[model samples]
Target: MLFIDPENTPDFKRSLFNAIVAPRPIGWISTMGPEGSVNLAPFSHFNLVSTAPPVVIFSCNAPADRHEKDSITNVRATGEFVTNLVTWELREPMNISSLDAPYGIDEFELAGLDKAPSRKVRPPRVACSPASMECKLLRIVQIEPQRPGDTVSNVVFGLVVGIHLDPAFVDPDGRFDVARTMPLTRLGGNQYASVGPLVDLARPSPRHD
Candidate 1:
């Protein structure tokens, strides 16, 4: 077994960090700047943190230059953003939006995608997304820089204020058909995977004394 310390490994991020995490959900976040500019970006460091009052978080790691990403910058400025689910059908457009464009560039137009107005947020949802969550800013936490010139992680937490689900993906039992959505997930080194056959496992019965 190889024992490696990240702090001592200069190339750990590129060599092992993301690979070890395996497949992670992509948070296709959309936000509107204070001046009304729109921004869209994909973050692998995103996940649902709470179920009650639904809270989600996305972390943005700043470059060595310490430049804040547009997604976090816009969320801080407007206090509103949307998380659009990226399915296999919408993967290309999602990847296009991930381009490191200029601050004021509209990713929707850049990707040739239409935006649907969100009910509880200023930022719009991707028209073609299978689902979306309109969120209100809860807080922003800045992780301390690990070392001089090291990148900082800005974590943004939000409360899901509203959810939009495509009726076509809803089951007769009122469940959102996640398996049918075929959501895309990020792997290491520019790789991605799509949701496949799911395994159902039931919890074990409680023991009786």
Candidate 2:
């Protein structure tokens, strides 16, 4: 096996580290800008951070030149945002919204996607999404860079104040089915993957003896 140290590797090898992490969930975060402009962006470094209060986190990188991404700026200003789950059907629009559009540009309109009112957040949800989580900002933590010249990243944590699910996608068991949801996920690089075959893994019996 070949060994590589991330700190000393070339930029291409560093990117491979992200790809080797396998498929990650895409965070289709939406927020309302200071002037009420709708903003949307996709982040691969996102996941559910806690379940007790249904908290989610998405990390935004501040480039060497730019102040911050639109999604990060909007969320900080409004203290509320929406997480729209990207599905196979909405993949194209999701990709379009990821464009580095200028500030105050409405990605929703840019992508030709309809918006749905969110119950607990200032930002709206993607109308075609199978599910959405309305979140209130909990905190924004600046992650210390590992290296001297590393780019800055802010990890925004939010509590899920509400959730919206498309009734059509609900199963008889009251559970959301992955197959029906057709959720899209980020693979390394520019590749994406959709829900595939399911495998059930049951828990082992308790050792009471």
Candidate 3:
């Protein structure tokens, strides 16, 4: 295997590395403005940052002219957002919300998605999503963008306040069964994959070496 240090390679090295880390989870974030405008978008640069406090992170890239996107703006205004898990069945509608729509346009209507009222937040949850996380904004930390004069970027960190999961996806003991959930993942540009197969490794028991 060839080892590459990003700084020593072409400018696209970092981007290539990220892409090679295939099948990253998507964060379908939904947020509402004070005027009740709703925004929805899928972010690939997302992951669970902490489990102890139930913290998650999703990167929000500013527009080309260098300003916060509607989703980021809405979250900043309301200080709350819902993260919906994209499933293979909902991929089509999920793609619709990924468009660059004008502000105040309801993505739910544009994407023809059903909105279920959130129990703890203003932004509603996608009815078709396998799972949804209601979160309160903890911080929006700015980061350097890939290109000079490109959009400003920041990873929004949130504390999960409530979790909504479909009963069918949960096991008898209340564990989320990935096999049944059928969650969708981002695989670079214009590509996606589903969760498949299972591999279990038992932890080592205490023994004298």
- Model 1, 1-209: lDDT tens digits are 99987678766664367878978999999999999999999998999999997999999778644379989889998899999999988888889999988789999999999999999789999999989999999999999888654677899999999999999999999899987889999888889999766899999999999
lDDT of 3 by residue, 1-209 (tens): 97776545555433564579888999999999999888888888889999999999998667765388888888888999999998888899889998888888888998999999898899999998879999999999998765543457888999999999989888889999866778889886688889777889999899988
Error of 3 at 73 (Å): 0.5
Q: What residue pairs clash in candidate 1, if any at all? A: none
lDDT of each: 0.90, 0.87, 0.86
Better of 2 and 3 by lDDT: 2
Mark the 10 consecutive residues where model 2 has the least summed lDDT.
Answer: 9-18
Q: For residues 1-209, what per-residue lDDT tens digits would candidate 2 score against the true structure? A: 98777667655345685788868898899999878899989888999988997999999679655877878888899899999999988899999999998889989999999999988678999998889999999999987778855677899999999999888888889888758778888888789999888889999998998
Clashing pairs in 2: none
TM-score order of candidates, top first: 1, 2, 3
Pairs clashing within candidate 3: none
TM-score-better candidate, 1 vs 3: 1
Candidate no. 2 TM-score: 0.94
Off by over 4 Å in 2: 10-12
